[model samples]
Target: MIKFFRKIRQKLLSENKFSKYLIYAIGEIILVMIGILLALQVNNWNEYRKQGQKEIVNLKAIKNDLQHDLNTEFIPGISYYSKKNKDLSRLRDFYLNKEIIPRDSLLKYFRNNWGEWHIILNKGAFENLKSTGIDIISNDSLRTKISSLYSNGYPEIENRVNIVKQFYDNEFGPILYDNIILYDSTHSHDDFDDLKNRKQIGNRIIQHYYLRTWLFERSELVKSKVELLIGDIDKEIERLDK
Candidate 1:
């Protein structure tokens, strides 16, 4: 192609048609410029396409995080807290209302249901987006929503759970060890029926009920938010695929 163009230029120059040669030269320059522009355009398009694909991958990864939490973490958390509340309610019945409940059942509830559900979120993808650039998300509303959920919503729940965990670790756990026989349900504690110890343990169970109730509501809200976000991400993915 270079040789052909060069031959044409030589022929035009040799003919001494200066006006025609000037026109041909100008046209050739325009063609070269056009070629350069087209190449640059194609390169720009390729970059845009790659970035778009990356955005899709990021969205999918985020969706995976949300889905995993919804199914495994949040859903289970909601159920766990609900059960906690119920068991605490049962304990409250016996302690507060003086309901005649069996010793074994009460002990089982106290011993087995005494744990907190720590929040285990998958923030890897979100952190990756932050590391690269959150603007990579493209959608303004989605970017804001996601940032809010991770930075604000998720953290709020985490803080609540941490408080519950701390209560168990620092305060309530020792009380349980002192007032309740955990390993052996049949073995009663020295102060199991003492008025002071009964009130203390009863008050703790009531407080636990409230905390678990709070956590359950929060879990439900976060789960709903995650589901909505997943839907939005699915739409974005479909749009990008197009």
Candidate 2:
């Protein structure tokens, strides 16, 4: 094709057909421009396809991370904390209402349930997404929701956990340590010898009840946010599959 065009241009030049040669030259330029444009269009399409594939891969990774959080963190965390709350309620009734529950039973429940519960979110994919640029997600709504889940939702839950932890460490823990005879397997006893002291600490336990309730509600909120995130992930995955 190049040789053919060159021969035509040379023949036109040799015949002193400047007008036709100029027209041929202009046509050649247009063809070259069209070829460049087509090449650019194909390159653009390839880039778009690559980006789409990247988005799908990221979405799948994010889905895996979210599922891990739900299974290994959120769901189990909720259950564990719910049981702790119930145990606390039972102890509260034992103390506040002067319920006739056995001392060993109450102490066992207290020993088992008392501790700081932390929510370890699976934010590996999320952190990577943020570092790589969230715009890669493509879907504006989904991207925003993902961002909110990490930035707002998870942090809110953590803040609640911290609040409860601080109260436990600074107030509740020391009080309980001083007042209650913590059950040890090596030196187990069924006697409620410190019942008077335990009753004295009941006022402090009642004071900390609000923190427990707040933490439980915040855990529920985290679960709700996680569910919403999972739903968005499912929708995005379905979209990608299609």
Candidate 3:
């Protein structure tokens, strides 16, 4: 093509056709400009596609991280077992010694304490997501759903925590502390025998308690949310793969 254009120009120059050569030269300049513009457009398109694909990769990573967090932090099945173990040990000591519920207020105090602990753990997980910029992206539906879940869900948790805290402040701490001090100083009567007698009842009550049930339910809820997040990530990955 270069040789073909050069031959035409050489022929025009040999003939001394200055007007025709000047016209051809102007046309050639316009063609070169058009070719350059086309090349630039192609490059810009490629860059845009690359950036879009990179965004998808980052989104997938964030989704996977969210799923792992949900599984590790929110799933309370393992934690439930651990708490039960410690509670069982504490109950055993109380019962084996026939130690009466040193003060009627101890169980009440524990009930509130357990509730607050669950709320605090849940709140921490929710806040972690919020601490990142997970909520600000305008177009991702799944991300928005997860963000809304944390935002809306958190107020309920906060309210529950407040109730638990109020109960602890008003009722449990003073009563339990006073009795714990007296019992420690006095070497109180053997209460384990009494505890053993009521072991079955205590176990049943623990299972039915609101704190345990609430934690278990919310744990499952978060697990489901995490699974949905994973599913969304899978879709995005497949899209990018294509």
Candidate 4:
């Protein structure tokens, strides 16, 4: 094609058709420019397609992470914290009313009441997205939501959990260790009866109640955020599928 165009230009120049040659030269330049533009457009289209596929994969990964969290962390966490909160509330009521519960009951309530929340979010895809470029997500709203969930929502939940855990460890743990036979798994009725008579036990029960209440509230908040994130992920996934 280049040779053919070159021969035509040479003939035009030799025939002294300078005006025609100029026009032909200009046309050739326009064609070359059009070709370059088309090539660039095709390259851009290919890159867009690749990014779209990558976005789908990332969205799916995020969805899976959220699903895993809902099943393993959020749902179970909500149930566990809810039940524990109720138990602690009942125990607090007993302490306030000066009512004596069975030793096994008290032991049961205290044993499973406290738990550490260590939420492990699957942030690999998110991190990659952030590092590579947020534009890869395509959808502005979805990208914003993803960013908010990872940056603000997750960190808030983590901070809340850490605060509660620190309070338990630093403030409440030592009191139980010092005053109660915490290590005695096989606690007798006498041990519980003795704990009831201790004046400081009421304060400890109150502290436990407060902690459990905080935990329950935090668990609910985390669950809500997780649900919202899941919804956004589903929407993004659907969009990507199209």
> How many clashes show up per model?
0, 0, 12, 0
lDDT per residue as tens, model 3, 61-172: 5665666556555555436534643554454445455434554434532443342343333335434545645543334786676566566654554455465456445554
What lDDT does model 3 reach? 0.55
Q: Name model 2 segments beyond 4 Å from true.
A: 14-23, 98-104, 184-200, 238-242
TM-score of 1: 0.86
Model 1, C-alpha of 96: deviation from truth (Å): 3.9
Instruction: Write out the backbone clash pairs for model 4.
Output: none
Q: List the residue pairs that clash in candidate 2.
A: none
Candidates in order, TM-scores: namely 0.86, 0.82, 0.51, 0.79
Better of 1 and 3 by lDDT: 1
lDDT of each: 0.83, 0.78, 0.55, 0.75
Q: Give the least accurate 10-residue stretch of model 4, judged by summed lDDT.
A: 112-121
Residue pairs in collision within model 1? none
lDDT of 2 by residue, 49-120 (tens): 888888888888888988888898878877877777777777777776756566447677568656767777
Task: Name the runs in model 1 displaced over 4 angstroms.
Answer: 98-105, 183-197
User: What's the TM for model 4?
Assistant: 0.79
**Prediction RMSDs, each to the true structure:** 2.8, 3.4, 8.3, 3.3
Candidate 4 lDDT over residue span 1-242, tens digit each: 99999999999999999999999999999999999999999999999888888888888877788788789877876687677777777777777875666766787766655555555556776787778787878888778888888888777766766766786677666666676654566567677667677767677668767866666686677678778878887877787778
RMSD of 2: 3.4
